[model samples]
Target chain A: MKRFFLSDLLAGLLFSLLGFYILFEIAYFPVDEGNIPGPRYWPRLIALGLILFGLWLAGSKIYSRRMTAIKPNLHHPHQRQVLTILVMTIFYILLWSLFGFFIPTVLFLLGTMFVLFPFQPKQKVRGSIRISIYSLLIALFVYGSFYLGLHVPLN
Target chain B: MDAILQAFVSLFQISNLLMLLAGVFLGMLIGALPGLTATMGVAIFTPLTFFAPPEQGLCLLLGIYTAAMFGGAISAILINTPGTPAAIATTLDGYPMAKKGEAGLALGLSALGSAGGGLFSVLVLALIAFPMARFALQFGPAEFFSLAVFGLSMMIAVSGGSIMKGLLLGLLGLFLATIGIDPIHGFNRFTFGIKELVGGVSFIPILVGLFGMSEVLNRILEGSLQDKVLRSKLGRVFPTKAEIKRVTPAFWLSSVIGVIVGVIPAAGGDIASLISWEQAKRFSKKKEEFGKGSMEGLVAAETANNAVIGGEMATMLTLGIPGDAVTAILIGSLMMWGLKPGPLLFQDHIDLVYQIIAILTVATLFSLVISLYRIQTLGKWILKLPDYILNPLVLLLCLVGSYAINNSLFDVWIMFGFGVLGFVFRKLKFPLGPIVLGLILGSMAEANLRRFLILADGNWFQFVFHPIALTLFVLSSLALLSSFKKAPSL
Candidate 1:
C-alpha cells in the first residue's frame, strides 16, 4: 500500500472506532434535563461520518491503485546520533530532577557537542575550538535568561 | 481620537517601548532557529511576563509573535529547512536564491516584505477591530457553530495532494479532542480512567512533539548530515529602488490576503502564506521565476506570514477568539491578566487595545531594524552549530518546557508519547498542521453543533437554512470542491 493511503486508512479507522466507543458509553451515561442534544448525540454523529469517510478512503485506495512512490533518499541515516541524543536527553532530565537546571544544561551542551562534531576532513581544529567556545557562551546566556533572570524554580 | 492618542502615549512609555524592542529581537532570534517555533517561543516566555504590568507584558508577547513570523524567513533563505511551518512556502524561492549566491538579497526582501505586511495588517486591525468585535458579539451558539464549520472547511482546500488524508487527520484530531472532560456537563468522556488525560492533551506538548520531535526523528533516520557552508559574500543586502517598485504590488496583495485569512478563527499564518504564495504565482509578471529564486515569491510568503500576526491578534483582542494556536495561548495570557477580551473589552478598555495596536506597529519597525542590522551574523552563527550538539540540548529544553507548563511529570510523558506518535506519522507522510487545527477547533465544533441541534429541535436542516450558517456552509463546500478538482483521485 502507498504509505499515505495506509496512514489515512488507519487514522480514519481509529477515529471511527473511538466514535463508536463514545457512542456506546453514551447509552449508559444519561443526559440531564437542561442539556438539549444529550452527551452522546454530536460525538456519535461525527463518529458515523468518520467511519464512512474511512471506508471511502480505503475503498478508493484499493480501486485506484495509485500509491505514492516512497523516495529512498529521504530516510535519515544517523540512527546512532539520534540514539545518543536521546540518551543525553534522559540524562539531562534526570540531572534536572537531582542537581537543578543550570548544571545539567551546561553538561548536555558540552557533552553532545564533543560527541557529535569530531574533526571532519574539511574542518579546521582552530575553527572547531572557536565554535565550542561560542556554543558555551550561548548556552550560558540561555541558562541565565531562563533560570536566573526569569527566576523559574528549577527543582 | 482622544482614546487613540492616550493609547499611543501608553505605548510610547519608555518601559513599554523597550520591552517591545526586546520582544521583537528575542522573537526574531528564536524564530530563526530550527526546532523553535513561534508558539513555543510565546509559551516559554509567557511566565516571564508575570512580573510585568499587564500592558507591558502583552506588548512584549505581541512583539515576539510578530517578529517570529518574519524570523522564519532567515532559515528558509540560508538553509533549505524552514525555521517554522509558516516559512515552508518561503523556502520554494528563498532556498533557490541562497543556492544562487543571493542569500543577502533574499533575506533583505523578506525583511522588507515582512515589515510592510505587519504595518498593513496593523492598520487593518486598527480600522476594523471595533466593528468586527461588535459584529462577533451578536453571534449565538448557532452562529459560532457555523463559523467553526466554515473554518474546518479550509482543511479540504489545504490538503495539498490528498483530501482523504486531510479529512482523516481532521477526524482523528476531533477524536483526540474528545478525550477530556465534557465541556458543558463536567463529565469525563474518553479519559479511560487516567487522571492525567482528564485535562485533555496539552496543545503545546503535542505541537512540540509533532514539529520539534518529528523533525529530530526524521533527521535521525535520514542520517545524511546537513552540509555546513559559509554564507557567500554577496552584493548589497538592501533591495534597489527598482527592485522595491517591482515587488510593491505583490506585497500589498499578499498583505490583504493574509489579513483576511488571519481574521478567520482557526486559519493562521501557515494558511495565509500558502494562499498568498498561490495568489502571487497566479498574478506574477514572471511566473516562471517562481521556485527559481523569484523575489516576488519570497515577498509574498514572508509578507503574508507576518501579516497574520496582526490580523490574528485583532480577533483575539476584539472577540476573545484566537485565529491560531499562538493567539490561543495569548488568550490564556490575557485571561491571566484579568482582562476579559471580547466586544465589551473595546467598550471598557479601548485605550489598552489601542496601545496594543500601537505597540504592534512599533515592534514591526524594531524587527526590521534588528533583521537588517544583525540577522546575517546571527544566522551564520546559529547554522554553524552541529545538529548533534544542538538537538540534544533542545530535547532537554523540550522536556523541561513541557514539565514546566503545569509542573506535572505527566506532561513530560505525554510529550514523549506525542513525540513518538509524531515521528511515526511523519514517516507515514501525514501533514501535522491539520491535526493540530482539528484538535483546537473540535470542542467548539461539537458544543455549538449540539446546542444548535437542540435549539432547532434536532433538525439538521436548521444549519442548512439559516442565512449565516448557509453562507458559511456553501463557502466551505466550495473550498472542498476546489480541492477535489485539483486532486480528484485523492
Candidate 2:
C-alpha cells in the first residue's frame, strides 16, 4: 500500500520547494532602481534563507531517517472525526458569510456540539434537544454581549 | 509631580476600581478553564474596550493578564490540568501535592508566590521602564534591524524542539511579512490582486485561529475524555513561618529570572516558569523532591509566571515591542484606541504609565485574596465545566473575534486559513510560536533593514561598526548555535 508523505523530511522538502518557487517569482519583481536595493532584494535574501534552512531541515532529517527507519503515523483513530470538524468549520464560515452572523453561528454551534459530543444511542432525541437549547442560549449570550452591548456590528 | 498625583486620583475612581476587580475575576475564571488561555481571553475581549475609557480598558485587560497567570495554578494543583500554557510547569509538583491531600496548602503557596512575584516584577518595571524607554529612544533603523534579528534568533531557544525547523518557520514568517506593500517604496509587493492582502495579513485572525480555533479542533479530535479532580475540599491556604522562610529565597530568585525573560521580546511566562523551576531545583537542598511534589518547585513555577506580567508590561509600555503574543495584541489594541506606545508614551502619557503600575499592583492583590479565600469554590466550578462545551464556545469565540477586528469576512477567511496552518504545523511537529513572532516582527524587520541599507548606502558590511548592532549579532549567533546543541535528536 502507498502512503502519503507525512514525515519531517517530506515537510522539509515541500518547504524548500516553496522557497524555490518564491525565488522564481522574484524574477518577475522589479529590479534595483536609483542605487537602492530593489523591491525584490529583501525577498531574495529571505528566499535564500528559506532555501538554506529548508535544505538543512530536509538534509538533516534524511540523515536521521537513515539511522532509524520509523513509520510516520499518518492516521489517527479519529481521523474521520477531525475531517468532519474541519468540513463543518468550512460550512460554518460559508453560512456566516451568506446568511449573516447569528443564524449561521447558532446553527454552527449546534452542529459543532453534535459533531463534538455525539448524541447517546439510547437518548438521542433528548440529548439533541438539550444540546440545541444550550447552544441557543450561548449564542444569544455571546451575540447580545459582544454584538448588541459592545456594538461590534457582527452582521 | 502633578501627573503622578493626577494618576493616583484617577486610578482610585470607583468606576476604574470596579473594572479592575472585574478584569481580575474574569482573568482568574478564564485562566482556570482548560483550553481557554489568557491569550484567547484578551484577544476575544479586546474589542469590548472600544466602548470604555483607555484607563478602564487597560485595567480590565491588565487585570485579566495578571490574574490568568495565577488562575492556571488552581487547576494545575487540583486536577493536574494546566488551565493555561503558563501553568504547565506547575503541574509537576502542584498536582502531586494535591494528590497528597495538601490542595489547600498548595493553592495558598501558589497564590502568595504569584502575588509576591507579580509585585516584585512591578517594582522592576517601575525602575526600568523609563530608563529602557530612554535608551530605546536612541535606536536608529540599523539598531532596530539588529534588534529584530536578535528577536528572531530567540526562536532557537523558544521553539522547544528542532532549531532548524524553528528557523525555517521564522524565515517563512519573514517572507510572509513581505507580502504587503513595501514599507519604504509604497509599491505593492505581493498583494496578488487581493485587496485585503494590501494591508498585510490581519494578525487577529492568525492569533485567534492558531491559539483559539486550532485548540478547539484539537479538542474535537480528543473526543471528550475529561480529567477528574482528586481533591475538591481545600484546607487553609497559608504557609507556616518555617515553610515561608524555606521558600522565600527561591521565590525572589525565580522572580528575578522571570522579569529578565519577560523583558525580552517574544518570550513569555511558559519559558520563565520552566527555567525558574529548573533553577529552583539547582539551588535547593531538597532537590530530591523535584517531581515528587516539592513545595519549592510549585512556588518557583507560580511566582515566576506571575512575575512575567511586570516585565512584559515594561517591554510593551516602553519599547513598542511586545514580550509575547498577548502583549502584541495589547499593543494593537492600544493603537486601536489612538494610544501609541514608545519612549514618547512614557513622556507624554506619564500619568497613564503610573496608572498601569497601579493597576498591576491592585490586580495582583485582588487575585491573591480571591485565590486564597475562594479557591475551593473556584476549583469546584472549574471542574464542573466540560471540555466539549468549551470546544464549541472557543470556536465561536474565534469566529467572532476574527470578525470583530475590522468587521470583515475576509479576516474570518484568513482566520480559517491560519487555523488549518496552525493545526497542520502542530501535527508536523513544528513550533507555532515562532510563526506568530515572525508575523508580528516581520514588517518591522523589513522596514528597518531597508531603511538601514539606504542610510548605509549599500555598504552592508558597515553594519558591524555600530556597537549595539554588532553586539546583538554576536549574541544572536551564540543563541543560534546554543539552540542547535539543545535541539533533540529525531
Candidate 3:
C-alpha cells in the first residue's frame, strides 16, 4: 500500500482534487452581465490542465513503479531539527501577534540562533554565551537598521 | 537621446552610486555563501528595497543582480564548492588554478571577463530591446495574448528534464494567480469571503516563502552548521595583456551565445555557461588543454554566465516575461512599486529604463575593481562564516520582509504555506521558475485572452490572423517540440 502511493502520485491526486474543488467553486461566482464567457472561463481552463497533468504524473509513476524494485526512504537525519524550526516559527508569529514586535522578534532571533548552534555535550557554557551575545547583536542590528534608521515601524 | 543623457546624470548621483556599491557588496556576500542563491537573495531583499526612491531602488537591484554573478566566482575559486549555481562551471578550472597558486590571476581574469561580457551583452540589449519594444507597441490584444502563451511555453522548456512537473507547477501558479477579483469583471473569484484575499495573494509573501524561507528550511534540514572551506591565499590578481588576448575570442563568442540563450526565457546563466563551455571546447585551438585549468574554459564559463544579465533585463523590460528566476522577483518588485514592466515602461519612463542600463555598466566596473582588490582577504573571511548563524538571519529577514510589506500577519502565514510548497516542489524536482513566471504573467495572459475573445466577437479563430500573433504561436509550438527532444534548458 505504501509502495502504491508515491510522492508524485500523491501530488497528482491532490492537485486534481484541488482543481475539482475550484471547478465547483466557479459556479458560486456572480453571472457575467455580458453574453460572453465569464470569470469561470480561466479557472475552467486551468482546472482541465491540472486534471490532465495530475493524471499523467500518477499514471507514469505507477507504470514505472511496477517495473522497478525500489523502496523510497522516508526517514531523514535532521527530522527533529526541521520540526523544531517549524514549531519555533509558528511560536514567533504567535508571539508577535500577542506582544508588539520588539520582544517577540528579539526572542525569536535568540531562539533560532540557539536552535541552530551545534551544542557540544562537554563544552556547553562557552558555546552558549557566544551564541547568546551573537544573537543579541544581530537582533539589535536588524532593529536599528529597519526601525531607527529607515523608519519602518516594526510594531 | 535626452533621456539617455538624463539617465547617465541620474546614475552618477552620489546617493545612487552609494546604493550601487552597497548592493554590490551585499550581493558579493550573498553569492559567496553556499546554499544562498542569487534568486533567493534578490527576493528576500526586494521588499526592503521598495522603501527607497524608485530610481535608487532600481539601481540597488541592478547592482545586486550583476555583482552576485561576479561574486559566485569567489567561492568557486577559493573552495571546491560553488557559491551559486552560475559558478558551478567556474569551479572546474577555478579550483585547479588555485591549487597551482594562481588564485589571484584566476579571480582577476574572471572579474575582467565577466565585466567585458556583461558590457557586450548590454550593448546588444540596448540595440535590440528598444526596437523590439517599438515593434511590440503595434501589437493588439491577440498579439499580446500569443506572446504571453509563448512565454508560458518556456516553463516546460526549462523544467530540468521534466515537462509534466513543470506544467503541473505552472498550472498551479496560474490557478493561484486567479484568486483575486477578475480583471475584466468586478466580481471576486477565489477570495472565499476573506477581505485580505480580495486583493489577492501578495507577491512579496509568496516570493519570500518560495525563495527565502524555503532555503532556510532546507539548510536546517541539512544540519551542517559549520562551513567547509579552503584557505587558498590569492596572489597578484591582474590579467596580463597576453592573457587578455588569448581569452578574447572565446569570451566574445560566449557572450553572444549567452545573450541568445538568456533572451529565450527560462534559459538562465547556468545553461548559458554550460553551453558556452561546450562551444569553447569545440572552437579552441588547444583542445587538449581543456578542463585542466584552461584559461579559455574559465573565461568562457564566467563570461557567458555574466552575459546573461543584460539579455535577461532586455526581455523583462520589453515584454513582461522573465529571463530567469531572479528577473521574476524583479518583476514582482517592479509591480509592488507601481511600475509595470512592459512596452509602456519604455514610453512613460524612458529615462528610468536607460538608468538601469547605465547602472549595469557602472556596477560591472565597481564589481571588477572590488573583486581584483579583495579576492584573497574578503574570500577568506566570508568562507569562515558558519551556516547556523547565516541561515537564522536569513529566516528572520524573510519574516521581516513579509510582515513589513503590508503590516499584515496573514501574509506571514501565507509565506509559511508557500515555503512548505516550495520545499516539496524542490524535493520532487519541480521547477520553481515556472511557478514564479506563471504567477507574474497569469493575469496579463488571462486579461489579454478575454480581451481578444471579446474583440473577435465570438469568433476565436479570426483573431489569430494578425502576423505577430500567428508568428508567436508558431514559435511557441516549435519551442515546445524542441524542448521534448533536447535536455533541460535552464
Please tell me which predicted candidate would have the highest TM-score against the true structure.
3
Ranking by DockQ: 2, 3, 1
Clashing pairs in 1: A75-B222, A76-B221, A76-B222, A76-B223, A77-B221, A77-B222, A77-B223, A78-B223
Between candidates 1 and 3, the one scoring higher on TM-score is 3
The TM-scores of all predictions, comma-separated, are: 0.83, 0.94, 0.95
* Candidate number achieving the greatest lDDT relative to the actual structure: 3
Q: CAPRI verdict on model 1?
A: acceptable
Chain A (alone) TM-scores for all candidate structures: 0.59, 0.81, 0.83
lDDT of 1 by residue, B1-490 (tens): 8877788787888988888887887788767776668876776566557557888888788888888887888878887778788898999999998888889889889999999999999999999998888887777777777766666667545646677767767777777777778777777776779888887877666666665566666655554334744457734589999999999888989999999988876677878888999899999989999999999999999999988877887877775666776776676577557777777788887777888888888888888987888777867766665666556555656666666666666666777677777777776656565676677667878888877777888777776657877787788888888888887456
Worst 10 residues of 3 chain A by lDDT: A65-74
Between which residue pairs do clashes occur in model 3? none
Model 1, residue B92: distance off in Å is 5.1
Q: Which number leads on DockQ?
A: 2
The C-alpha RMSD in Å for every predicted model, in order, reads 4.3, 3.0, 2.6
Fraction of true A-B contacts recovered by candidate 3: 0.62
